[model samples]
Target: MFNLYFISQSTCSILLLLNFALKNVACNPVVRTKSGCLKGSIDRNIDGGKFYQFMGIPYAEPPVGDLRFKAPKPKHPWKGIRNATEEGSACPHRREKRFNQSVPLVGDEDCLFLNVYTAELPRNSATMKLKPVLVYIHGGGYVFGNGGRAKYGPKNLMTEDIVLVTLNYRLGILGYLSFSDPTLEIPGNAGLKDQRLALRWVQDNIRRFGGDPNRVTIDGESAGGSSVHFHVISPSCRGLFHGAIIQSGSTLNSWPWGKLDGAISVVNKIGVKAKTQKEALDVLKSLSAYELVRVLEQMGITECSNDWQDISPVIEYPHEGAFLTKSPIDILNAGEQNQVPLILGYNSKEGHWMNYQQMAAKAMGTWVAPFSWECIIPWQTGIKKGTAKSKRFADTLERTYQTETPEENVVNAWSDSIYDVGIEQAIKFHLKTHLAPIYAYRISVITRLNYLKRSLNLWDKPGVFHSDELGYLFSQSITPKVSPGSPEDIYRRRIVKLWTNFVKYKNPTPDDELNVLWQPVESVDPIKQLDIGENLTFVDTPEARRFVVWNELLEESPFIIN
Candidate 1:
């Protein structure tokens, strides 16, 4: 009898071990997409709220070989359940350098992937209410960055009832190389096309992941922010998203908007004797993806240069699949844009990042060059360099922002020239025919979560640097962990709430549970904005005097306003 009881106990233990192993192997959630079934994983937010993550889902086919420099093709359907627990490779781009060190290239050419995060998964689609979607496009000056969770994690955002998505698009030469000849089939703005395709993918498949397609809000920072504005103006992107949140970027930003002689420059740099556009195209296509990106690095192209020439978005010649065919200013002036609810703004000191290296050099007592007035001249004014108009504008800028030091002058001057003027201009043009409310803001809150500023050793410096507000919205890996009920945590929570509220209700202060009645810009004469600082104060005509000078200067310039 004792032997029989021992044998029964052993048998039960073996069965229990086998059951545990099976559960571990097959417990992941699987969602059926139009392309195929995607197996995602579950994660818990900082607040211990459970959320579902679907990572590295291919939205477009690999733009390789013949598909290079062309619009992304839709990803073909796949068989069986695809493992989406891991992130796909980022698009081909050089790794961000630190301390002026040369970084190796990272990512793959076949990197058209996107990640989706949702707080809840629908058990029964017929009875479940879908959540609002927030599609984020990352910014790297149209050259670097990815939609990976390491940089743009959904930990804080997942605590709210929303579906978050981040996507990877083509970058640099591979994405924006355009030939003058339309017949060459290389119209620029392929990167923008990649983004548009991802949005379409969201519309068609987001519902399956418990997302509401009709209530999608597109958000981006820097180049990605400008991308959001581009979509807002593009006729093809109408109805894809209901609202836009543009942070530190705009279509009117002179740096990344206009076409440059990129194709000719590439041909000359690569030593290709291409006499015709087709020959240049052939030579470009023959080069490997790594070779193409290596060339861009060799060109010494860093983000936020005073020089406007770069491989960025351009007005493409009219073609069947051209992403942008006209100037964004013209499009806005004609009221041909998608007129969605917009929340556009910049940091209190947008130029801090641009002047960081110089500031550091000064602090270290290193040899720093004298400030050049030419750098501060607004490139959008179209005044020729060294011309009488250019000198007059530069002189005016020097007098206007009369700071104690040249570095301070640079910070203020670049802030207006590079970021503020363009964004304000976009708002002005958008308001001319805007039927929807425009919520403008200036992020001035400073906290421990200011990762970008801290990383550059500028945390102790005055003024909130560009992209400081991003730390409050999304939990990045570099940022220190926020303690519950801490000041940083409270600020982060408030920012997230405001953004998510805009995503849901199109009004940031839907009910003002946060006790801040954020108002929208009612007129361009004196643009009102929410100053997100220690206190959410409503400021009217904050930049009126500054912009008046800009307006007068632009009016005197030769560039005709449509």
Candidate 2:
């Protein structure tokens, strides 16, 4: 992500006038921004109306060579105007070829680009007024994702009175490896820094795009939600955004620095070592990016399941006490994080989407694909051991998701025990420190998407599955196979209303006939689960039991213990 330096309005207007004059005063043409902008084309098909779109705007310089693992640096100022009408390249990552699904292809190392959508062209001085900003971070387990993905088109989101911003960040080995030298404090989590840089960029130039930097709301799902959790605690991210929305993912998957020893060992297998931290960093940075990815793959580093070997943020080592300090939990506990309004939540049946039984059957029956071979076994076994804790944790889970043996049971158990529980912990932490209004929900919209619904047969899993709410919340049409009668249609409307309401008012209360008031999570009887389905309900009960079981499982007997 790009480092940002904000110049005052006088400076901004002067820059604007100069840019406008350079362009010969085009019709409501958006002048190139400081990071360098290009005029966008108008599209009538988007958002039920015509909207202006600017794609592939660079937020940071490329993270290649020695800059790979360091904090993102600002892009060098451009001279002539740059073309941003087309989407920019996505970051480099190992692509997974899936059935009927075209995987997002590889692009470039300098993938810190963004796309913007607005109702109309900024009409000169009128567009300079501050409008609320909605900055979205995409989700891919911190390993795969880019803002270029079509699922996140901002046409509808932009139609509202909000400025929509979407971005891409470094992923995989390129983003999260921790170099083992004490002096090389900045080894891991360059991707997170990339996110902060993007936010900083938004703060600096969003006004030019008709957005209020101070009223920005950072939002995301899955890994992106985890990113929001990190932002809540990160000192570097303190002033970058005013509100946050974490959907379906949290920092529960995060492992402390010491837990990464195994991953560090693999990173060292390239026959490169150093006496000091700086020397170590120099040696690692010197290796080509391909060479680094190759070495991590060869050593079974990248093969490990997501939980056992984490790519999530940790307090930066060496600089842990300094530069990048505090995990989400730490910040919340100390009451030191940004105490802004929040909408943090998860799905009711988050694990059903993984389809652990099918994955395990495949892993057990065949020669695992290189990626699957390395990832499946350890991940499956890990979750099984942890699932032995509670009946609700075990029975309810296994009933919906069946496995041949105890091993598969462990895998499914670990997935929920680790992931779903993490969100619960975050909720508890937020309540401890934050006095601001907190709205939480449990996405219960069971999709008509037969594939996802069929997978739910493992047991009678309820209304929600991990990410099942995305399509609905974004108002994406349901699959033709999923019967979308009145019930399904109403479910879609409710989710869209909840999300858009949150974006507009910093709360999920919608101004419609189907509206329902949501209560803030507080010290007493803190759990608030909004069942977002054909019929919405308010569930007020403590969500701590599951948290307790899962936390214990993580502490005492991790299913995927390294």
Q: TM-scores of the models, in the given order?
A: 0.91, 0.77
lDDT of each: 0.80, 0.60
Q: Candidate 2: misplaced stretches above 4 Å?
A: 1-29, 45-47, 96-105, 124-129, 180-185, 254-263, 268-291, 294-307, 318-323, 356-415, 448-463, 475-490, 510-513, 523-526, 540-562
Model 1 Cα lDDT, one tens digit per residue, 243-344: 999999998876675453466666766666767767766777777887878766555532232355647788887878777877777887788999789999
lDDT of 1: 0.80
Question: What's the lDDT of the predicted structure labeled candidate 2?
Answer: 0.60
- Looking at candidate 2, what is the lDDT of residue 540? 47
Question: Which runs in model 1 stand beyond 4 Å of their true positions?
Answer: 1-26, 98-101, 258-261, 269-274, 302-306, 357-371, 540-544, 558-562
Best-fitting candidate, scored by TM-score? 1
Model 2, poorest ten-residue lDDT window? 96-105
What's the TM for model 1?
Answer: 0.91
* Native-to-model Cα distance after best TM-score fit, residue 468 in candidate 2, in Å: 2.1
Residue 82 error, candidate 1, Å? 0.8
Per-residue CA lDDT of model 2 for 1-562, tens digit only, reads 4211233435445544654465443333344577554556555422356556778888888887557766778888764445557788777755422111233446578788988776543445354666777888887667666776355666445446777888988876677766545555455677888888888888887766777778898999888888887787777677888889998777644322223323444445556554554554556566665555454445332222433553445556546323355455556778987888888887765655455434653554422232222132234234432343433344444453354355444444444444555676677777887977888777655655322354334435443555666655442333332243556555655565566677677877745556577777774243666765556777542234444444544455343212
